[model samples]
Target: MNMQIENNFSYHAPKPGQPEIYTAIREKAKELAYLIDEKAPNSREKSLAMTKLEEAVMWANAAVARN
Candidate 1:
């Protein structure tokens, strides 16, 4: 099977003492997850994307808890 992946992700380091950055990360993660779902609903790629999304949410949650 041939798969086509399309991504346009941009990363910016979270500014010190700015908790809002975590929110932004969470939002971007949601968008990426949606794209993955739409592109490959029930496949290995979707599972991988979901795992990455889970990781991003974990990081965001950690940052939120720390602040």
Candidate 2:
């Protein structure tokens, strides 16, 4: 039997100016993309979720750029 376990990974942004923070964000985005792909009920919902995630990453990048 193939049992699929649901993941609840939380992304915590690391210290500013550290590479770890970027890595963390990238990993988090990938996880979110996977969850969105797997659990979204329909294409519209999936598109919305992906758009939101993209916006969030852009916002994070902007914040980092400002610092």
Give the number of the best model, judged by lDDT: 2
Q: Which 10 consecutive residues of model 2 have the lowest summed lDDT?
A: 1-10
lDDT of 1 by residue, 1-67 (tens): 2222111133334467556766777788888888888888697877987997898788676645543
* CA lDDT scores, all candidates in order: 0.68, 0.69
Distance (Å) between predicted and true CA of 62, model 2?
1.1
Ten contiguous residues with the weakest lDDT in model 1: 1-10
The digit string of per-residue lDDT tens for model 2 on 16-44 reads 56566666777899898998888888778
TM-scores of the models, in the given order?
0.52, 0.62
* Model 2 residue 51 distance off true place after TM-score fit, in angstroms: 0.9
Off by over 4 Å in 1: 1-17, 60-67
| TM-score of candidate 2 versus the correct structure, residues matched by position | 0.62
**Cα RMSD (angstroms) for every candidate in the order listed:** 12.9, 13.1
Instruction: Name model 2 segments beyond 4 Å from true.
Output: 1-19
